[model samples]
Target: MYKSQRELKKDAVRAFLKDCKEGRFDGAYVFSGEEDYLKEHYFGLFKKYFLGPGDDQFALTVFDDMSFVLEDFLDELDNVSFAMSNRILLLKDVDTRKLKGEPRKQLLDALAAVPQGTAVVFYYDSAYLAGDDAARRARQSEITALGKSARLLEFSRQDARELVGWIRRHFEAEGKRIDDQTANYLILVTDADMVALNNEIEKLALYVEGPDVSREDIDEVASRSTGVNIFEITDCILSRNYDRTLRLLTACRLNREEPTVILYHIGVMFSELLYVALAAARGITSVDTVAADFGVKANRKFILRRYFNAVSTLNVDFLKQCIGLISEADRNLKKSRLNKWTELEMLIARMISAQIRK
Candidate 1:
């Protein structure tokens, strides 16, 4: 049967939960994904089923695959649990993609013969995986081999709709409410990292006495991630808010953000703005249509209005010049001996000056 990727993920989670409920802990399991929240949640659930209080040190064994020897891990698996029916072996940050030759064969053999009375979990945070195609193929092969004797699961990022629902439920659990619009706005102003989102939600719940969470509440309480800060900085540049732009640039420096990174983001923002502006000039004014054209997310579609307004004040030639300036700054930051902060400051000053002169 050919199931869609979404369907496969859903089935994997469902099967894992069923096994946990039935107390049918497998001999070996593999968790490979980018979503840390679900990964940690399932890890806790497995622990609850396999161990009791104070049993971790006795019955649980943890190893970092990078440093731990394969023979040592296999030896531990062969050993019996201390004062428990089963031992839990957790292998963290195991990127099978990097395994080769002897180590790879040893790991495959161990997976084939995971010792009795041992619950082994091979966990990897996909976020840390290398972006190269070779690494990706290696990971896929590893997952396939492990799947022969282990329950393989993957946790992917949720879409905007699911995120909004999660936010609403979380707020409700804390005796508060957040409307859909406000929830989407929250996502727009933050990274899609669930751990950070959960922390922000909890902070908002504690800070706001009212039942409803507003955009104002988010702005005041939620810590802006670097991505969010870059977006704000770009917004400031587009609006020609000189003081605000400089303030944000200072904030970036204070936080020790690299000048190259800031310049890269600014270039991206300007490029995207140019695309939206060009589309609008061609009479595509609908936000949904324009966003779809640019492959922008629903939550971020709100930025189109700002982009449109900013683009109205500037021409295509000037936007291209701004992009060129950012590129030049990036090169100077990397190749030249100039101070990073000074180069970034000059870039921003020139960008603002260009906007004014236009």
Candidate 2:
């Protein structure tokens, strides 16, 4: 139900803080996601917003195991907030498969009877919901029953374009500037993780002069010569020049990098490109819409604006082949028997290079 990551985090925090500030936060939450820092950041946000950055504090109980009984949750829920403040029962994901008939039924029944003046929040992996029939069913049931009383906040991952802008925002805040190539290079290296990318950019910027960051500056100032190498490989692939691709591949291997990581990055890039190319061939005018259709939710708007020209180059067939090659390479790259570098090299040369339009 939630569209973007920012919206989910902001809206959820705001609502919880409002309730906590009003002495109303109660019941349980299923907080989920693979991003450990963000998860912990949210916990801090809950503390700050509810605890008022001052004298009052929220009481929180955490349950992290599948064997946790239904009464464990209710017992905490029944407890009043310490001195007129909010209380949070944080339920980490439970193993639904492990639950037998009565336990499963009891869990569902417990969900149905969460106390009034209490809110139940679920933080979970975005992918986890697909297999979770009970969670999906519970949410659907809530929409019909709880009205505004229940809230579902979703945190989504950033698409490419927004991720780029996020990189730019970091540089801007640090009183630094970088060209498109440098910025994209940095993002590619960090795998679009804003926090890591920003930190790396700051380190790079610190090595340079005031307010002007560039590719040359990055090359000169980088201490380890390891950042954004993935972007360099991507640049070669996008240029559609086999020599460049080969050259970059050699450079990466010479640097003592993990061969599988290279293969994985290439696989991701080509897959994203294929998404655009196929969508364009199908008459989707905007990457934003296409991203939604394909569930490629990262940096979509930024990707459309910046990379549309490149994406529009490939025909649907090209995208299909490219995706197939990437898939095969992905499976092969991790194999114990194959030389990862060689397999990746063949994929780039045979599959990706063959798909080059110009």
Candidate 3:
């Protein structure tokens, strides 16, 4: 089977940790990627392994925010500190590739000749090396150059399997239990980032009355992403709960979610629901079979099930009308200066009305 980038990175991170635990040290390392939480996490472990307890200022040097000087870095690297046996120099947000000609050569040469018991870490914080197309190409070029001299590790978001396991463990640590399915559902509704998920897990642990976490508990307590809010709004519409639907739409506005973004999700929801409706008509009702037909990821099969729950109440004709309404709203949102919430409210009314007439 083909492995994903995230899976490769996850395996690399595991190997890196194992090496650290076994006292294996690299001369210089580059930490780069979108997973800020894990990057910061492993950096803590890096310090723990390299500097140990009660780290001294003399043992560690941090150069950040354009404060790095080549001479100063070389001096620090060669200082041979008596305060500690393992010394580390951290270069945060420093683009070493900017050093041209001799300076760049010297930097590489310094890395090559890094003294025993000393280590250097070049950390590219999230989004630091990314922007436009040119910037991204430049970042890649820099990473390629640096990779030749340092151990390069990219930290990105974990796959759904890892995230699901993490959620289950967090609940377990809180003296509560959550099954794989419910934990995965939490990930679906909430932000998948570790920081946000951690906070949500804490909230759920404290708010739940029983030992086992349920989907109901998650729906009641977990923070909803814009996607989740729109899902709820669609569900309410299917149930003919107009008041609750309008309330959720207003809540989306209050949360500062853009109407265009909200409309885009609404369109997607209808499209998926239409697919479910068609599948039901064909007597293909299994969530897995429908999800596979639609190319939905394994982690998101719950979404298909949700749509299936509401599909029995609707038919293809009404779903097609809803999509047409969304397209019209999209045009209005682009062409006019109408009160955005008013436009969405009107769109909701029309969609609900379409269901009523159907």
Over the stretch 1-358, how does candidate 3's per-residue lDDT look in tens digits?
9986557777888998999999998999989986777898898898898778884576778998489999888888878544347888889989876799999999999999888788899998877865656988888778767978998888876546788888888889999999988877787787456767888899999999889999999888887898778888888777778899888988888898888889888888888898889999999999868767886555456677778878787889999999999999999988878887788888888988998999
lDDT of 2 at 174: 82
Candidates' C-alpha lDDT = 0.79, 0.60, 0.83
Worst 10 residues of 3 by lDDT: 295-304
Ranking by TM-score: 1, 3, 2
lDDT for model 3:
0.83
Residue-wise C-alpha lDDT for candidate 1, range 279-326, written one tens digit per residue: 878988787687667776544565666687777777988898898999
What ranking of all candidate models by lDDT puts the best one first?
A: 3, 1, 2
> What is model 3's C-alpha RMSD?
5.2
For candidate 1, the clash count comes to 0
Candidate 3 accuracy as TM-score? 0.69
Q: Can you write out model 2's per-residue Cα lDDT over 173-219, one digit (the tens) per residue?
A: 88887766677655555655555655677787678776878766655
Misplaced by over 4 Å in model 1 are: 1-7, 23-26, 50-54, 80-84, 130-151, 271-322, 353-358
Worst 10 residues of 1 by lDDT: 77-86
